[model samples]
Each structure stands twice: as structure tokens, then as C-alpha cells.
Target: MSDKPKIKVLVVDDEQDIVDLLKYNLEKEGYEVATANDGIKAVKVAAKFIPDVILLDIMMPHQDGVETCRQIREIPETKKAFVIFLTARSEEYSEVAAFDVGADDYITKPIKPRALMSRISALFRRESKKEQENVQVRIKDLIIDKTSYTIDKNGKILTLPKKEFELLYFLAKNPNMVFSRDELLQNIWGADVFVLARTVDVHIRKVREKIGEDYITTVKGVGYKFD
Candidate 1:
């Protein structure tokens, strides 16, 4: 007999067999699991269940995962939910699109249970440490508290991921000094992380979306700034 707190996971897809497969394998790995057949329903289920992570299908019958992810960001309960896209799309654009919509990782479907678990575990480990920082970067109307990891815009609480918070933190620390995407990827996401330069753009877009549309200034071919 083994006793460990089960990590709750939400698997959203329109296909019945896929959902069942993921549920079976995830439970086998000692995780608690739930399911949703469409994007809107995914959000509803997530809100009610408060899953630790959400495995979303990019293409579904209603709403689609991209839009669902955008909406999930607006919900306080699921705002920081670890999001991974499980899709059949293989195009680089699809990958970029997934990140742009706020996914932490992407896995093409016909997913292997072991690989999925590995990726999920890695994200959990990274996030556990990320949850402990102290933030108090002052940018006009916005105040980011690193310890609490929350953004307040003119007294309103904002939902930002642990990674986005760090990106904003580094930029805010130097306010007006531009950092190249590669530089940001090294300093913020870590030099060891094999992620695309575009990932930084995705995170920045999400940060700007939450703080204000004009919060982050892009230097076009260069990098970004907090002016």
C-alpha cells in the first residue's frame, strides 16, 4: 500500500477513447483525473474541480483549446493552472499558436503515457520552486508582488504565470533597457531550457494582456522593454 497526495489532472478532448485512455493511464500512475469533451466544458470542469494541471486538445467541437486557455487565464481559480496542449497538429505554426495562447508545453497526440507523465512531472517540479518568489516591481499603476506572485493593476489583482512574472521582474529590474529574446530565454527561462525564442513572445503577450495592452514594449527585431 502506498500513500501520497494524488495530483489532480484534467484531460479535455472530444474523442471518447482518447479521454478514457488518458484517464486510465494517469490513474495508473497514481494521479487523480477528470475529463471534458469540449473547450467551454473544459473550463467549467476545471473551475469546479480545480485540477493541478490541464491537458487540453487544441481542436475540439466547441470553442477550441486556444480560446479556452485565454479564458482560463481570466479565472482566478485556474489562472495559474499548468496547461499543456495535446493535439494532432504537427506544424511549427501550430506549436507557436499553442504557446501564444498560453500553454506551458505542447505534446502531439497519440500520446505516450510515460512521456506525458515525464513532461508533467518536470513542469510540476519547476513550478514548485517558482511559487516561492517575492515580487514588488512598481510600474506606474501596476504592482507585482514576487512572494505572492500576483499582479495588481490600479488595485485589481492580475493573474500571471510564475514564468511571466520573472520575465516582467527582470525587465522591470532594468526598466527601459532592452533584452534580446535569446538573452531573455537564458536569464528568465534558464539557459538549459531548449525553448524557442518565440516562447518569450508568447509569455510577454500574455503578460501584456493581463497588465495592459501597452505594458510591454517590443523592439521589433530586437527584444522587449518595460518603458
Candidate 2:
């Protein structure tokens, strides 16, 4: 067996068959897998499992995936975990809501296991490459550390959800350079993942909310830049 630790995955859905399908495939791919049939239990399981990735269903009983994702992101242990919403809902609003709650990817499903596996692998592959660059950026009172995935703003350590941290770090790294929404999505989310351009706007707003507007400036008719 490889010495590398298995990547842990949490599969949350109200459907037992879907859970079993994902659990079986994920384990077969050498990941450690955990499952929960409802959002309530999913939160509990995620707190303890601290999975590297969470596959969540949006329409579960007890609570929906959006709320569950929000709660999970609030948890210290799971804040950095990647959340992907796998739902049957195909509405544009559903997709927007998923991204608003910090979902890394959204997929409407007949649940093609092979395609899903590829997407999951792609996420890990991108993350693995990112781990090689252990650099930090300092501007003003803010310190963005890629190694710890945390920010020090005026000596107070602040933690952001994974995507928010990455968006801020990326912009901060290339200060004063304006990047269009499509470019940001490609660079941050990668070409393999299909994310809406509006997702970039949402993330930018969120990063601003956490770190203040003085850092990122929105240029009308253009995109955003780190000020």
C-alpha cells in the first residue's frame, strides 16, 4: 500500500442507495468514506470525520444542504473541507444558492459514478499541486499564508472558508492586476470545473466582507483587483 494517507470523504444524502453507491465507489478509489442519510446527522458525522471532501444532497429532510453547508463551514474542523452539492434540483436559483453557501461544485444528478469520480479526482489533483507552493503574501496589516490557509489581519488571526481564502489569496498575490471573472474562475476553480462567472462576484463580495473593501477594488465594466 502507498504510504500516503487516504483522502477522507463524507457522502450525505437522504437516499440510502445513493449513499451506498458513492461510498462503494469512493472506497474503491482508495479514499476513506463516511456516510449520513440526513443533514442533521451529516453535520454530526462531519464534525468527527473531518473529511477532506463532502458530497452533499440539497433536498434532505431535517435540514437542506445549503443550511448544512453553512453550519459545516462554521465548524472549525470542517471549515476547510470542500463541499460539492449533488442534487436533482436543476434550477438556476438552486445553483446560485449552493455557491452562496460555499459549495465548491454543483452537479445535478442521475449520478454518473465515473464522471463524479473524475471530478473528485480533479479537485484533489489541483489541491495536491497547490500544496507545493507554500508561500505567503503580506500587504498592509494583512498576512495571507498559503501554508496555514489562514490570514493575520492586524495581529488577529481570521479563518475563512476554503474558497474565500483562496480568492483573497489569489487577488492579493497579484496586487493591482485586474482579472476578469472568467479568468479568476479558471485560475482558482480550474478549467476542469464548470463554475458560473457570477460565482466569482459572490466570492469577491464575501472576501471583502471578511477582510474589508480597502483590499479588493471592483472596477465597473472591468473585474476586480487587489488594491
Candidate 3:
């Protein structure tokens, strides 16, 4: 067996069969898997499991996935975990809410195990490639560190959700080069993941909210750039 650690995945759904199915398939692929049948239990499991990825369902008893995700993101241990929403809701608002709560990917369910696996693998592959190219971008008093996934502005350190951080870091690195919404979506979310163009705008807005508006500039009718 390879000495590299097995990737830990937390599968959270109200359906037992779906959880079991995912757990079985994930284990077959040599991943360490954990399961929770409700959002309440999911948060408890995630706190201790600290899985690298969390597969969540939008609607659940006690707490919904969006609120659970928001709570999960607040937890220091699970903050960096990739949260993928696997739900039956495909409405645009549902998708937008998922992304707003820091979801990395959204898939409407009837779960195809193979396709889900491919998306999961793609997430890891993209992350692996990113780890190899990690660098810190310092712009004035603001410091964007890809290594720790944190930013420092005027001596105060703040943490952004994974996508927001990556968006900011990407723009800071390129400095002054305009990238359209489609381009940002392709580069940040990757071509393998199907993310809406509005996702980019949402992320940019969130990033700006955290880091302030001085760093990223929106070019009218064009796109966004780090100035």
C-alpha cells in the first residue's frame, strides 16, 4: 500500500441507502468514508472526522444543508473542507444558496456513483496541482497566502472560505489583468466542474466584502481585475 494517507470523505444524506451506497463505492476506491443521516449528525461527525471532503444534502431534518454548511465553515477544523451539495433541488436559487454558503460543487441528485466519483477525483486532482504551485501574493498591506489559505490586511488576519480565497489569490497573482466571469469560473472552479457564471460574481462580491474593495476592481462591461 502507498504510504500516502487515504482521502477522508464524509457523506451526509437523509437517505440511508444513498449513504451506504456512497460509503461502499468510496471504500472500494480506497477512501476513508464517514456517514451521517441528518444535518445535525453531519455537523457532529464532521467536527471529529475533519474529512477533506463533505458530500451534503440540501434538505434534512433539524438543520438544512445550507445552515449546516455555514456552521461547518465556521468550525476551524472543517473550514477548509470541500463541501459538495448532493441534493434533488435544481432551482437556480438553490444552487445560488449552496454557493453562498461556501459549497465548492453542487450536483442535483439521483446520484450516479461513477460521475460523482469522477467529480470527487477531479476536485482532489485540482487541489493536488494547486498545492504544487502554492505561493503568497503580497499587495501593499494585504497579504494573500495560498499556503495557509489566509489573508492578512493591516496586521489583522482573516480567513475566507476556500473558493473566495482562491478567487482573491488568483486575481492578486495576475495583478491588473482583466478576467471575464467565464474565464474566472473556468480557472477557479475548473473545466471539469460545472459552475454557473453568476457563481463567479457571487464569489467576487464575497471576497470584496471580506478584504474590502480596494484590491479588486470591476471593469464596466468587461470583467474584474486586481489593481
Candidate 4:
């Protein structure tokens, strides 16, 4: 028997066979798994289960993965769960869109069960490590708390996605130090993340929009630094 506690996972896909297969394999790995047949159902299930990870299918009836993920982020109960998108569309645009809407990871469909399991395991491990670091930074009226995985601006709590929060926290922690896009990717997402430099821009845009534009200064042709 494994000593680690069971991590809850929610599988959201319209295809019944895929959901069953995922649930079976995840259960065998000693994870607590739940299923939802559509995006609508996924929201309700996620609200109740509050899973540690969510395997969300992109194309689905009623809500679609992007919208569903956004809704999940809005919900305080499930907003913190790590979301991984599962889709047959391997286009870069789709992957970018997934990240734009708060997906922690994106995987093309027809993924091997073992590979999926590995990704999930890695995500959990990263989250665990993050929890161990209780660093907090305060810049002006903004407060970035790594321990709570939250940011507060002028006493207003900002509901930022995971990547956006991490990006902001990283830049803010170092104060005026400028970091290139490649450096941000390597430090934040690690080597295994298959995302382009443009993805960093997308996350930066989101962070700026939420926390105000002056928080991040773009150093044309160089990179970005926290103002």
C-alpha cells in the first residue's frame, strides 16, 4: 500500500468509454476519481468533489472545455484545482487558448494511459513542492502569498489563474530584475512543458489586466520586469 493520500481526480468527457477507462486506470493507481459526461455536468461535479486535478475534454456539448474551465475558475470551491485539457485538436492555437482560460496543462487526445498518469503525478508533485514554500511578497498595494496561492491588491483579492499568479509572483519576488520569455518558461513551466514563448506573453497580458498594467513593464525586444 502507498503511503501518500489518495488524490481526487475528475474526468470530464462526453465519451463514456474514455471516461470509464480513465476512471479505471486512475483508481488502480490509488486515486479517487469522478466522471462527468458533459461540460455542464462537469461544473456541478467539480463543485461537489473539489478534485485535486481535473482532466477536461475540450470539445463537448452544452458548455465546451474553455467555458467550463472559466466557470470552474470563478467558483471559489473548485477554482484552485489544477486543470489539464484533453483534446483531439493538436493545433497551437487551441493549446494557447487552453492556457488562456486557466488550463495548467494541455494534452492531445489519443494519449497513452501511462503518459497521462505520469503527467498527473508530476502535477501533484509540483503542487506539493509549491505548498512547502511559504514565501510572501508585498509590492505597493499588491500582496502575493505563495503559501495561500493567492494575490490581494488594495485589499481586493484577485482571482487570477494559476499560471498568471505564478508569473506575477515570480516577477514581483525579484523586484526590478528583467526575465526573458525563455527564462520564465524554464523556471515556471519547467523543461517538459511544450509551449511557445508566446504563451508567456498571454499569461503576462492576463496578469496585467487583473492587477493593473503598471505592475508589469514590458522591455521592448528584451523581456518583462515588475514595476
Q: Evaluated with TM-score, which candidate comes out highest?
A: 3
In what order do the candidates fall by lDDT, top score first?
A: 3, 2, 4, 1
Candidate 3 displacement at residue 59 in angstroms:
0.9
- In model 4, the Cα lDDT at residue 50 comes to 89
Q: What is the per-residue lDDT of model 2 for residues 5-118, given as tens digits with 9 covering 90 to 100?
A: 899999999999999999998998888999999999999999999999999999999999999999999898788788889999888778878877878888788899899888
* Model 3 worst lDDT window (10 residues): 131-140
Position 27, candidate 4: lDDT: 94
Residue-wise C-alpha lDDT for candidate 4, range 1-227, written one tens digit per residue: 66887889999999899998999999998889999999999999999998989999999998899999999988887777889999999888888888887888888888688999988878778777766765789998988987667888888887678788888888998889999999998777766567778999999987888788888999999999998
Q: What's the lDDT for residue 111 in model 4?
A: 66
Off by over 4 Å in 4: 1-4
Residue pairs clashing in model 1 are 133-146, 133-147, 134-146, 134-147, 135-145, 135-146, 135-147
Candidate 1 has a TM-score of: 0.78
TM-score, each model? 0.78, 0.94, 0.96, 0.92
- The stretch of ten residues in a row with the least summed lDDT in candidate 4 is 186-195
- Would you list the clashing residue pairs of candidate 2? none
